[model samples]
Target: MTDCGCDKAKAELEEYLHNELCSTDAEDIREHLAGCVDCESELHVGRVLTEAVQRACRETAPGDLRDQVLLKIRTIQATH
Candidate 1:
């Protein structure tokens, strides 16, 4: 496992939050976080933001959005 100082740890923190890091990198970040208060706090913030974004992104579009989009596309194509 490589050593990650504060900068590298902070940079990869979002990946860590999503559990997307490889074992070596994850462990390095974990070890860094254990000893770093600022990074820990940043990790918490990252988690909150990531979860909020994920929730927002998972929402389905309005019921008629697809129909509306298709209608618009068809209209444009007909005009062309």
Candidate 2:
């Protein structure tokens, strides 16, 4: 949401969040995040989004539904 559209910063953020960044890049992002209010806000939003998705996923699929999926997989595997 910054004037630059924050593309470079957002890329860094995506990598940082996934723990896929190299040490130097991660440190640079960490420094930027500490000093830049805009990027910090973006990072906070990203964390909230990640947490919300995790919580939502936990609420999906009943035990019976999982059994049904496993049963279907077994049926297909048996055919092939």
Candidate 3:
């Protein structure tokens, strides 16, 4: 398999990390990452950032804050 090069790999790194790429494209990125330290480091950073964001997204707001936000939304909806 040919290396997809740094540009394509970097551009699609997010999609690769998220398993959003099709098999062939993903394979190309995989091949590129295997041989390129820079792109691999970039992929690692993307993975860490993605994991952090996912963890943050999984966290729930405090009940009081959630209630306040819901109340504000209802007030706005009522006015509209």
Clashes in candidate 1: how many?
0
Q: What lDDT would each prediction earn against the true structure?
A: 0.91, 0.80, 0.95
Top-lDDT structure, candidate number: 3
RMSD of each: 2.2, 5.1, 1.7
Scanning candidate 2 in windows of ten residues, the lowest lDDT window is: 1-10
Clashing pairs in 3: none
The residue ranges of model 2 lying beyond 4 angstroms of the native Cα positions read 1-7, 63-80
Q: Kindly list the per-residue Cα lDDT of model 3 for residues 16-50, writing each as its tens digit.
A: 99899999999999999999999999999999999
- Candidate 3 local distance difference test against the native: 0.95
Segments of candidate 3 deviating more than 4 angstroms: 75-80
Q: Candidate 1 vs candidate 2: which has greater lDDT?
A: 1
**Clash count for each candidate, listed in order shown:** 0, 0, 0
Cα shift from native, residue 28, model 1 (Å) = 1.4
Q: How close is candidate 1 to the true structure, as a TM-score?
A: 0.74
TM-score of each: 0.74, 0.64, 0.82
- Per-residue lDDT tens digits for candidate 2, residues 1-80, read 22333566677787788888877777777777777788989999998998898899889688899999999999999999
Best candidate (score: TM-score): 3
